[model samples]
Target chain A: MDSRVWDNRAWLFVVPVMAFVLFSSLIPMMTVVNYSFQDSMGQNSFFWNGPGWFQNLLDPTTAVGARFQGALLRNFAFSFTVLAIEIPLGIAVALCIPKSGWRVGAVLVAIALPLLIPYNVVGTIWQLFSRTDIGLLGVALGRSGVPFNVTQNAGSAWAVIVLMDVWHWTSMVALLCYAGLKAIPDAYYQAARIDGANRWSVFRNIELPKLRKVLVIAMLLRFMGSFMIYTEPFTVTGGGPGEDTSFLSIDLVKMALGQVDLGNAAAYSLVYNLITLTVCWMFFTYTTHADSKDVA
Target chain B: MLDRIGLKRGDEVHIADASLELHAGSMNVLLGPTLSGKTTLMRLMAGLDRPTSGRLVEDGRDVTGLGVKHRSVAMVYQQFVNYPTLSVYENIASPLRVQGLPKAEIESRVARAAKLMRLEPMLKRTPAQLSGGQQQRTALARALVKQAKLVLLDEPLANLDYKLREELREELPRIFAETGAILVYATTEPAEALLLRGSTATLREGRITQVGPSAALYREPGNLDAARVFSDPPLNELALTVSNGVAALADGSRLPGDGALGALPDGAATLGFRADAAAAAVAVGGDGRDPSHPAFPGTVAVTEISGSESFVHIATDAGLGTLVCLVEGVHAFEPGDRAEARLDLARAFAFGADGRRIAARPAAAPRREPVPA
Candidate 1:
């Protein structure tokens, strides 16, 4: 084989993407970094704080620090609770989808309808549908002797938020799983049948192994989306009945807009992003490492 | 044994009423081109697919509705399917494990198959880690471990390299035949069919053209379609018009029609020959004067010299069209050079207008003739 000649001209094509990233993400993120290091007052007046806000945020004794800790734990709880119900439910739904014919197109279009809805629209729709005073679900629950209120009950508020999250995003997981399932060759199923494998053995040994890559992707996307969730709960429960459903995104917005504390909000935002990135990285390496080990 | 199997999907008939009797301890080759229903026929025989029409009886019992699982069958698909995440050892052991065989028995069987396929060293690696031939070998090893009554290999050697294909082409049929299983191997290469030297079934457009002993079938194809199916470089076709016991082409070349070609009811017909049986040489005068053979002036379109033979493409004069001639020993014929092509009439077969053989394998010999003025 001939040795490849090194060409540097390809770097010019990457310049446009770099410039676009600079304007779209890097510059704005630099502003948050600037705020994290300074103290801000009314009228955009600022003083040099030199990590003082970050120090207080990490201490867990200050008011902002306590709220951050509470919101962080609540985010973990909500993320796990939603994912536990969504993953298995998504796989089941994906498995039941018709493999071929016009019905496949119809069912796929129906499955994707919820995902096409805008976030605020989904939140508002659920709010009207679950209201205790005039909502069908709330009325039915109230009449059935189950205490259901978004405003006065913490347990009920958590339930509605979890249910709404599941309803909104299980479709994402299911669609990803469906695509993965469709990519598997029909020959694998035939070969398994010839080997006399039963249904569970086929799923465990064949389908699950083939689906691992897509499942990892779905897990990461859903984990981040669930951990940073805000819109549905904000419109429905208002993160209230106490701080039960005030996840990290809701708490960050509250510190930034509701409390008008720019310094604390900026610091919280950076740490929240760092946590999400670190956890996702850890999960990816752990799972992929296990994957290579499984093959080897 | 396949009894009148047919598969129709929607309005398209994929396998049109095909039947063959497959016996144990024998090697059978399904020779056909792509989309010729070779794989579909094999799938129907394996019970992987149920025929839309007709029944499949095996061992004198009807198995049209029987699933592949309940039947003792193993198949290596064209696109070899091994558990991508499992080691080669496990891939080969999968069937034995499913059968709940003892660990010692499974180990011995897998080891034996691995040895036969030369896959012993790569037993610990996965399919993703193996090359195409090694992956194919892993799939073959899996099929071997089953020791089933019916084994189907769909283009198993098509993806292998030239040397590996030749090597496995010899070993596979022998190994499967040793188990006394009904082995059905499908390939598009007619040379492969000849090499396997078993019973050969030639298929075309979902129809079985002919099935018999391989060498004898190649010698005397039941019809023109079967003869064409058994040709590697594609059969050469020429139009012949026979009138009052004399056959002539549009280019003024002539042949005595007292032969099998004339045995046709004295009208327009087709004459087919193999590339190797025809020869093309640079014209040095006296080109279109031979009456006992097909002699026509042509212009060389291409010349390919390979190994010990040369393939010369010539566009014949008149409306005879282009024909390929495979000449033994190297011959240099450049493009645009005038040449003469001749067919060995003794080896040619004549077909009627509807593509059915009028007579098999030179039923009438060409008689010596005088040059036409």
Candidate 2:
């Protein structure tokens, strides 16, 4: 048996990353933890609240608790909706892209264009692009006799938000899935053909299973990205048409910056972060477990 | 008929006018070197790719326009492409599942194929957990479970180790024989072609040069390319002068004209000799010179000894460059040793300027010459 040499010297290479994380992440996180338990009055004077904010935030009777529950439920619904539409749409687009040719590069560049735009820029672009009179989509829908006013209608507001998110981020999922699809050897496709498998059968047996790992990653990224969505909806909808599209991040910002409720916002932040982390961890664990069972 | 069928990528032809009739229940080999269109021809036959011009007719039905999914064909690739996420059982049952076969029937067929490939123990394991040979076996089992009318194995044993290749090669024919599919096996190794002993079709440079029984093609290749394809270690070719019913070597030795050479027009020709033929002549006549047969003196350039056989490379003065002679057991011929190899004119092949074999020579007698110890 070969024994590994004990080398303390290798730890030196890790020191820079550890120091960066300490300054960038741990310090800020500790500040949020400290703020979650204390109430701040004028002139930065503070008194211990001792979980008062957490208890009120957890309850549904108070205004803060009610807002938290509404935002949390809306966030879950929005995340599930985005995943439902984007994952399949991304897979379909990925499958439709040609396997080889000069067109592959052109198509990939076109798909990746939306992802390169800044979040606020994407929101501003969509905001102008969906206006009732001048915006192309709204004007076209109005000309076609459809009642489409994102500024006044809750359904229209949700529609525009979901549509904008899908248009901006589905390409990310497609690119990830395309990378996974490209890794499969041509031999697999050839073998599938020779096995007399139909198109659906081929996709079901070969392509989908091959894309499972990439799908998990796409799901987690899209879930977290859509759950914490603020700038796009805030810029385009302004959490408006009566707080219809206000997700958790937008509500958190409203409570902390707009209402100046520092203690409650801090508690909300910790709870929100915990919820996202827990859900993502569960998804990761489930997928990895399924993958291990497959190999076994 | 693949009358005008060819494959061209941009401007270059991959397989040009490749037409052949394959029979059912007999293994046919597409034997060629690398990039010689063997796999292309197999793909065309299996309906995986359409010919640019020609149509494929199977049992009097034109299948050129039909896709692979519409055809009754199965294939085993060189890379052992099993579904990585699926167990061996599901991989084998995949085609049946596509057909929507009854679950019980699919299970029984999978079990049968698994038993035939000796993969019953690993039925529940995924391809990633299996060895290379086991993965190939899983692929073979998948192909067998389909029981398609046509089976194309594209160098299936090429990626396997030596012993595993030998073992699988022995079992391949037995497995296919029971399925009654028209099996088309492709390989670059001449020894593999000979071992499979199928009706071999020799291909070269996107053209089917010759088609015949494997042993017959080995014994009488139709052209220079076919001879090269069927020969291992390559046949030794010599540029010689034929004048007045006699072939004269560069070393000034003359071989009397047989019936085949008697009809030649007395000009330059190519002489082809297998390694074993050269060794036989060298073994019987130690001095590498025999009066009754054409012989030449040469120095050994290189020697390779493998197990019970030794291949001695000889650089002859006959303007024939180097010739490799496979001597049986062991010989004491080292590099730079002076040796002579006699040519049995009757057993040798002659090609004209166009590289087509001149069939004028009578078949040689099967008598072994005595070693004059």
Listed in order, the DockQ scores are 0.44, 0.36
Error of 2 at B23 (Å): 2.7
Which residue pairs clash within candidate 2?
B5-B54, B260-B360, B260-B361, B288-B340
Could you give candidate 1's per-residue lDDT for residues B1-373 as a string of tens digits? 6777889899999998798998887889999999899988988888888899888888899999798988999999767788877899999999999999999999999999999999999999988789888999999999999999999888988878999889998899888888899898999999999888888999999999999888878776767889899996788888888777577886666653336343566777788888876789777665355545656578999988986998888898776888889888888888998987777777788787777777544544555532211
Give lDDT tens digits, candidate 1, residues A53-93: 88888879998889999999999999999999999889989
Docking class of 2: acceptable
Residue A236 in candidate 1 has what lDDT? 87
User: Each model's RMSD to truth, in Å?
Assistant: 5.0, 5.3
Off by over 4 Å in 2: A1-10, A42-53, A142-147, A283-296, B1-11, B52-71, B82-111, B119-135, B234-306, B310-350, B359-373
Model 1 chain A weakest 10-residue run by lDDT: A287-296
Task: lDDT for model 2, please.
Answer: 0.85
- Shift of residue A275 alpha carbon in model 1, Å: 2.1
- Candidate 1 global TM-score: 0.91
**Model 1 local distance difference test score:** 0.85
Per-residue lDDT for B130-149 in model 2, tens only? Answer: 99999999999999999998
* Per-prediction TM-score to the true structure, in the order listed: 0.91, 0.82
